[model samples]
Target: MNKQQLQQQIEQVYLDILIELNLEKVDTYFAPDYVQVTDHITTDINEFKAHLEKLKAVVKSLTIETFKDMLIDEEKQTVFLRYDVIVEKKDNSIGNIEVYAVFTFNDDGKVIACNELTKEYDEQVKGLGSI
Candidate 1:
């Protein structure tokens, strides 16, 4: 596929992953040896899925913004997306957050690696620190 097509595919995969959390069509969207780079460290695909499971407990719902700004690298099969997100909590509270992600895809159009950046959109309510 072309660069734009590859990027769009990865972006759609991510949207599905986040909205559904803890469960994903990994084989369809990612290589078995997928890796992820985060603000803290890098890990394999399984590790990333486990991390998502943990995150799901805290974030009930997610809304992504600025999808049109996504960048793609077809030659290397990479995609970069910078977005804002609204997260819903168990208590019906909501927080806005900013996140950036880089994705690398395999020849099959499956994501093989990813790098993600995240930050709270505002100071945490009740002095919890941040979103």
Candidate 2:
């Protein structure tokens, strides 16, 4: 896929899967062999889907506040995105997080792998601060 197409697919994953909590979109956007790596966990497609299901059950609402600096490399079939997300839980507690994610797509334009780094914001501090 071209850069523009890749960008649209990536955005759909965030909008349709994450923010919208539409688990049905998982099969549409991700390859069967999809894998994801993060600092605390590595998950294959099934495991990832289970995790999302759990989140969907517990989360009252989710919003993507910003999706910034999306860069797509057509040659590598990769896209990078920086984003901020706000999530409210069933108990009404809110959490904010910033993330940087790298997504790799297969030739068929389905996401095959992803790696992400995230920083959870402190409700008191507003920004990262020294202890």
Candidate 3:
């Protein structure tokens, strides 16, 4: 994919899957063999799905606060993204997290792997980045 298309794909994944918690969109944007490593914890597609499910259960709302940076490496089929997120839990507590992630896509433009790091900007939520 071209740079623009790849950038759009990355943004759409954040909008559709992460912020919206739309589990169905996982199939549309992610490869079946997808894997992710977040904060040194690795998870396969099934585990990823479980994490999302758990997130859905606890989170009342999630917002993308800002896209700090985005870079596309066309030759490597990878995109690097740094963003901040605000999350509100069911109990009405809020937390902020800053995430730096690298996404690698397949030729078909579906995400196949990701390596991510997250920092908790506030103490309201512990381990919020992982789930």
Candidate 4:
């Protein structure tokens, strides 16, 4: 697929898996041997799914606030994206976070590897404090 197509696919996957918390759709975007590296841990596809499950348990809702930037390197088959997110917890607390992620896709356009960094802001009172 072309760079534009790949970028759209990546965005769809993020919305489906991250924002929607649809673990069942993971295989549509991630390869069987997917690997994820983050500040706290590195995990394979199964482990990543488990991690998402844990997150879902604590988070009541997640929404992407903005797509700050996106860069695609066709030659490297990699895409980098920066975005902001708002997370609502089960206890009704809200948190805003900024994320930078890099995804490497296989020839089939399935994501085989990913690395990300996230900075979470302090909790905010409803309709009050800045993110």
Query: Per-candidate TM vs. native?
Result: 0.83, 0.89, 0.96, 0.89
Error of 4 at 93 (Å): 0.4
Q: What lDDT does candidate 2 reach at residue 58?
A: 75
Whole-model lDDT for model 3 versus the true structure?
A: 0.91
Model 2, 10-83: lDDT tens digits are 88888899889899889999999999986557889998888788888777887886787788999999999888
**Positional deviation of residue 98's Cα in model 4 after best superposition, in angstroms:** 1.2
- Which scores better on TM-score, 2 or 3? 3
Which 10 consecutive positions of candidate 1 have the poorest summed lDDT? 122-131
Q: What's the residue-level lDDT of 100 in candidate 3?
A: 95
Reference-based TM-score, model 1? 0.83
Report the candidate with higher TM-score, 1 versus 4: 4
**Candidate 4 TM-score, C-alpha based:** 0.89
Best candidate (score: TM-score):
3
Clash pairs, candidate 1, are: none
> Model 3 over residues 31-123: C-alpha lDDT tens digits?
999999999999999899999999999999999867889989999999999988888999899988888999999999999999999999888
Backbone atom clashes (below 3 Å) for every candidate: 0, 0, 0, 0
The alpha-carbon deviation from the true structure for residue 77 of candidate 2, after best TM-score superposition, in angstroms, is 0.8
Model 1 spans with C-alpha error above 4 angstroms: 123-131
Off by over 4 Å in 3: none
Per-residue C-alpha lDDT of model 4 across residues 1-131, encoded as one tens digit per residue: 67888789888998899889899999999999999987646889998888788777878888886688999998999999998778888889888877788999999989999998777776452321111
